[model samples]
Target: MEKTYLRAVEVDQWQTRQDITVTIPDSFDREVMASLPSLPDEPEKAVEWSGMLEMIGNASGVLWQKDAEVESLKTQIEIQKKAMLDECQGLQAELKEARDETHRANAAAALATNRAIKAEAWLQQVKEALASGFAPHLGRAPVERPSVLLAR
Candidate 1:
């Protein structure tokens, strides 16, 4: 069995009309001729496939160009997809870092709150000590003294 490499191609319906000519492979030409009946130079009845003939006349070397353009666009789409994925990953990483920082800030705030509570208790003790008038030689509390407000 003989194998022929053939690629199925699609072309844009819009084609140029510059009177370009093309030659098909001999085997393909022979096969087409053998399979289909030949059209007469002049026919009495209207041809069924005459429209297809006119369209084919404009599609000789233009299909490859459109095909290449399609391929290039597909490549660009893939590149854009990769870049978007990378950007998403970067954003996710940034979110994780922000969450970590938030947790650290919350921890620091809790520690500060605890220190403030302890400091408030210590300040209360100091106020009591001051009221008692800490005099080591005298006593914890002095006898009832005259009011300075009355003296004034």
Candidate 2:
């Protein structure tokens, strides 16, 4: 009977390589070994190794799905952040416009107040001139008027 050596390769967490050996039984089914991608010489050990490989594949698939979900969430968060920033900028512009309008209103009110003050001063001058009997001399040809002399 020829002895066959079965090689098992295992990698650590750090990906350091290690080799394991198991003896093959002579009575092992050749048909089952042919179906497996990598043949383990021992029948019982082959079943265990195949199960472990299946588990590793399943775990890797789950990790990949989780990574994809994380990426999608990150993209959504970025989009929301950009929208919020745009809203803030719009509000800032509106605030600036409101401030400018308020300033313009204040300037208009000040001008109105100044014009009212000048009008009041002119009215006072007119009142003084009329009280002093100087209204007839304003912008017209002089007319002779009879004056009554009063004794004080």
Model 1 stretches with alpha carbons more than 4 Å out:
1-57, 134-152
Where is model 2 more than 4 Å wrong at Cα? 1-47, 129-152
**Tens-digit lDDT track for model 2 on 1-152?**
32333333436667743445444444444555566676456545445544454466567557656766897999999999999999999999999999999999999999998887777767766565565566466756444443332222
Count of steric clashes across candidates, in order: 0, 0
lDDT of 1 by residue, 68-152 (tens): 7898999999999999999999999999999999999999999998887777767766665666575545665543433232110
TM-score leader: 1
**RMSD to truth, every model:** 11.4, 13.6
Tally clashing residue pairs in candidate 1.
0
Q: How does candidate 1 score on lDDT?
A: 0.62
